[model samples]
Target: MTVTNTGATPARIRLAYTLPAGLSDAGTGGCAPAGGGEHRCGEWASAPGARFSTLLRVRVDGDAWKRMPLSGSVRVTATAPGAPGVVSDDEGFAVLFPPGPPVPGIRLAADAVSFDISGGSSGLEVRLGNTGRVDAEGRVEVALPAGVTVPTPPSGCTTVSPARTRCALGTLAAGRTARLRLPVTATPEAQRQAPLAGAVLGQLDPRSGPTRQVQMSFRITSAAALATPVASPPAPTGSQGVLAAEAPAVSDGGGGGSVRRTAILLIVISTLLVVFALALATTSLRRRMTAPVAGPSAAPTE
Candidate 1:
């Protein structure tokens, strides 16, 4: 502020000014009295037609700048000794806050993964990167679908619940990336496509706020679908080996036919023996009947 005396005679003058609330003098560039909220310059003798100026440095409160208007007034009182004090009109000024640093940006390198059911223990590497100018500190959380389990979690990660894992990322500098390896085991129930959702909690700001979600999907398939089929071995070609292979089957058929023939022959022989015995008995009976009367008369004469 500059004070000029345009009168013909030298004069004594004082200037008093008050800054707005939430603003204060930054440095002692100008002479002012102490203990008062307002800055006061004591009476000074100014040469006729001479000008005087002093710097008024000020600083704004950080919290107040964000919530309140940036405009304020500075009241100044000027006077010449022995004359009525003159109150100048209020001087208005505008405050401009400096721009804040850029926020952190999140990106996922891949958006989907597929695993074979017979692949045993499979893994997916998720790349998390920051694209802004500030460091990011937050917790990364992942939610896996049913029938899939985290066999080996990434570093600094812990199992929060069934199929849910949380990893603490301490600080990621600008343009840096962190690779998280999530080893998973798939079951038959994990056939169809399943959702795999992940998020970084406190990326841009330290306080809790909205987060960016990285959504992905996964599916399980048969190992045959992923690999080529193996061919069967060719059969043996030599006649000797072929006959040896058929020998047991041929023997089984022949043995069963031989047993059937033996049973039939034995039944025929037993029927013939009974018929021959009956014929011999019939002949002896007939001869005994014819000679029975003569034998009895001879026995009586003796």
Candidate 2:
């Protein structure tokens, strides 16, 4: 910043500067961090027509390398005495750093995915993050578990097979994330159980510790598991069994009911009479056998 006191007398001059994110105080040109990336550069008394310059230095943070949305701005505001009231101007300047490093680190996050069977499609979401300091050409290949299918793929995505899918991401900026959603279909079998899944970084250096292939359990929820259940009827009570053991009877209005009862009574009486007659004949045969003394001679008397 250059300041010239063009007024007749000496004037008090001061400047306020702001540094955007991804930048920090570099400590130069008699500048110090006032607070929150802002600096107070002057409180100088300059003579008439005296010209001087103020330099503000800043350094790019290591974390900002290759990260996206890095359009940072530096705001410069100057205040001095002028003919027309107090003179003040606020200006913004764009600062660009050389292209960030080319290394990209990928970390993946997953959510439980689900869809309807009859509808034949559901929303699929996968979150991918750039952990390195460079922008990356992002892409991912997906192979669905048994019984689920990827039928229709969107633009920039291809259905390599009934079970496999691939999607292209032009460039994923560092420290940023890409959210992917693809439509999918599930078979009846997918609703029965949850499946195991994981991801392995395939680029320059495979993240060993935290970024290593993450193995996680995921399930494709289906419609069958979500169906409502039906209720059952109640059991019969004791009063219902009072006449359940008897033969069911047919009833006619008036005279018919009376006639049926009479016929049942007569049949019971006849059965009893026949049983009594058989008992009397058995008693007579037993007595004749016990008293058979002069059986042959007595036949003459007969």
Superposing every Cα of model 1 onto the true structure, what RMSD results? 46.0
Q: What is the model-wide C-alpha lDDT for candidate 2?
A: 0.51
Candidate 2 lDDT, 18-46, residue by residue in tens = 66577777876656678876776646777
The residue-by-residue lDDT of candidate 1 on 51-87, one tens digit each, is 8777777777765433222333333333444444342
Top lDDT prediction, candidate number: 2
**Candidate 2 ranges beyond 4 A from true positions:** 1-104, 116-121, 192-217, 226-302
Give lDDT: candidate 1, residue 77.
34
List the candidates' TM-scores in order. Answer: 0.34, 0.35
Give the Å shift of residue 93 in candidate 2: 58
Task: Work out how many backbone clashes candidate 2 has.
Answer: 0
